[model samples]
Target: MSRLYGDPIEVWTREGRPVQFVWRDRLHAVRRVVDHWVVSREWWKTSDSDPGERRFWRVEADPGSRIGTYELRFDTAGEGWLLMRAWD
Candidate 1:
C-alpha cells in the first residue's frame, strides 16, 4: 500500500527530468525513473486558476541508504512540485 502526501517539495532536474528532491527535510536522490505520464483536464476552460498539464514521474529514490518508491508531480500552470505518494 501507498500513502498519499500531496506535500510541496523542492526538486532539482536534469534534462527535464527529476534528479533529486527535498521532501520533509530529507534529500532524496532519484536512482531510476520507473514510469512517466501526463494528465490534462478541462481543456476548453481557460479561465480557471489551476488549469494546465500535470506531469507525473514514478521513481525509485534514496534518502541516505534507504530506498523507496515515490510519485512526484509537476504542475505546469503553477510551476510547483509535489511529493504525491510513497510506498513503504
Candidate 2:
C-alpha cells in the first residue's frame, strides 16, 4: 500500500456517497465502496486545523486500465476532499 498524504482531490458524490475522484492528475471511477465511516474532533488547537466531522470511504476504483482500492476523506469543516492512500 502507498500512502498519499495531504493529496487534494476532486470528488463526485450522489446522495452523499462518493462516486468518483481525481487524484495524481488522474481520474478514478469508483466501482464499489467497501466501507464508509466518520470521525469528528473539537476545535481547540490551531485555527488552521480543520475541525468538525470528516467522512471517509474505502472504495475500489478503475482508472481506465488498472483497478485499485483507495481511501478518501471529506472534511466537513471546510468541505474539502482528500485522497488519503491507495492499496496495492
Candidate 3:
C-alpha cells in the first residue's frame, strides 16, 4: 500500500521499466524493483475522470552514500509520473 502525494517528477524508463527518477530536485537511480502492482479504475470515480490501469512499482533507490525505498506510479492520463511516497 502507498499514500500518494501526487508530486510531479521526471522519470527515465527503459524497456517500459523505470531506471531512474528526479524527485525533490535530486536524482536517484533505481537499483531494483522490490514489487510491482497495477490499479484498475477507482470505484468512486466518475467515468469521465477514470485513469486507466496505473502501474505502481516499489523500488530501492540509491542516492550517493545513502539509500532508500520509494513508491512510484505512472499514470496513463493527466500526470505522467509521480513520486507517491518515500521510506526513511
Clash count, one per candidate? 0, 0, 0
lDDT of 3 by residue, 1-88 (tens): 4455768889999998899999888999999999989887665553555656689988999877688889999977554888998887
> How does residue 20 of candidate 3 score in lDDT?
95
C-alpha lDDT of candidate 1 relative to the true structure? 0.94
Superposed by TM-score, candidate 1 places the C-alpha of residue 1 at a distance from the truth, in angstroms, of 1.5
Full-model lDDT for every candidate: 0.94, 0.87, 0.84
Native-to-model Cα distance after best TM-score fit, residue 58 in candidate 2, in Å: 0.5
Arrange candidates by lDDT, descending: 1, 2, 3
Q: Tens digits of per-residue lDDT for model 1 on 1-88?
A: 8999999999999999999999999999999999999998567844476678889999999999799999999988889999999999
Report RMSD (Å) for each prediction in the order shown.
2.2, 3.1, 3.2
Give the higher-lDDT candidate: 1 or 2: 1
Task: Please give the lDDT score for candidate 3.
Answer: 0.84
Model with the higher lDDT, candidate 1 or 3: 1
Show model 3 residue runs off by greater than 4 Å: 1-4, 43-51
**Which digits, one per residue and each the tens of the lDDT, describe model 2 over residues 1-88?**
5767768899999999988888878889999999999887666732565557888999999999899999999988778998888888
Write down the TM-score of every candidate.
Answer: 0.91, 0.85, 0.81
